[model samples]
Target: MITDPARLLVYESDGLTAYRTAPRAVVLPATTEEVVAVMKLLHAEGIPVVPRGAGTGLSGGALASPGAVILGTSRMNRILSLDPENRLARLQPGVVNTRLSDAARPHGLYYAPDPSSQTTCTIGGNVAENSGGPHCLKYGVTSRYVVGLTVVLADGEVVVLGGAGADPY
Candidate 1:
């Protein structure tokens, strides 16, 4: 937990830079288990939780509330699994968008929807905001490449939405 105002200032806004709000605290959880634990503790105390992914969102979606806690996904970045045959990759939300393409390039694959900020934007933020870039006009957006998600609901329940082999259609 980061209570230092100097550090909390970093979580005040995102790439947009138009809107800003200082959060009460900043919590960087490195794992899903840690995220869940923080959420449970915050839920019991009635503290609001704001999920942030790299702070690269151009839409100010990552802006923290007046007294909410910012849960950054930077430390959670890890490529959990990769299935080249199935063209699937299970990654933590903190994984940079370009990192995925870089890793999959060795397998002769690449993630579509190349946002201009892919190098710095997190996949989780892209998925959450349905972000896209120049390639979107031809290859669609992040939603198309996203096969699954593991989300923590408002009630602090951890749920896996889809799987590597799960059919979206």
Candidate 2:
């Protein structure tokens, strides 16, 4: 069983302070295989699932339900790759918003979008809602940065969204 004294409560309320539930179990899977396995298990039981990142959500999107599986990706943070020539940075979904930009600082490049919760919001959640920021009008939103996504459905079916190229959708 997943354990973390405050995991449950934090799941319910991260970004939004008023509405919170915290979760019964909080899993931090470091790889795609682990994420798929847990999702498949939870899906088999037909349980509610809430995928979370930095817990800095303000829209109550990360709040947990009565009987839900809260998947926090904080532990999966990592920088997978970086291409200086192409001016691109590849990182895990759990990577922090500021972390990405911080890494890009010396390269004379940076992530275009800078949300208020950049310091705490995870890249996973940013991908979920296709986040936006003040510079999006010109720099574009999170959707522009994501070249692809490795997603696992409820039934343990893994799917790859987008591939290397110009099409990010």
Candidate 3:
């Protein structure tokens, strides 16, 4: 991996024209195990984790703190499964918001919550921000479309938010 100060700065500063403090390092994990391992390392070292995708965040959520490790999920942008029958998709967090609709288009289905940055924003970021869009008034925000999530907690344990049962909210 090409890990350098300038590279990390570019990745962190993509969304904002003016930003501060690049990252100490950047990692692109391809699998759940890899991501969890990185998280565990950060936790052990007391280094902060900044989860990012597409760098489209208008706010500074993706911005890196000093010496923090920037975890860009862009490389993990893959649709694991799309079940039109179930009206859901098991997706990696880095998948673009609009990409879901594109993937769903073949089945005449679409993921709701088409944010203004749908083409650029990532699902994980949307989940974190509870991001809303123009159609949200009628449809709902990304929170509504999400039936479940595989979350990594602060302790570095992987947990599923929802199971085979219904939404279970």
lDDT of 3 at 101: 91
Per-candidate Cα lDDT values, in order, are 0.88, 0.80, 0.80
RMSD, every candidate, angstroms: 1.0, 1.9, 1.8
**Preferred candidate (lDDT higher): 1 or 2:** 1
The parts of candidate 1 lying over 4 Å away from their true place are none
Q: In candidate 2, what are the lDDT values of residues 1-169, reduced to their tens digit?
A: 4766653555668677987675768887888899889998988898877888887767888888887878878888998887767777767779998888888888887877778888888789888867878888988888888887778787889998775565654
For candidate 2, give the lDDT.
Answer: 0.80
Clashes in each model (backbone N, CA, C under 3 Å)?
0, 5, 0
**Could you give candidate 1's per-residue lDDT for residues 46-155 as a string of tens digits?**
99988999888888788887789998999999999988998999899999988999999999999887788889889888988898899898989888887678898766
**Which candidate has the top score in TM-score?**
1
- lDDT, candidate 3, 1-169, per-residue tens: 4377566557757466587667888888888888889899889989898887777767788888877888888888899988888776889989998888999999999878777788888898888778888888998777777777888765579998774455635
TM-score of 3: 0.90
Q: So what's the TM-score on candidate 1?
A: 0.96
| Top lDDT prediction, candidate number | 1
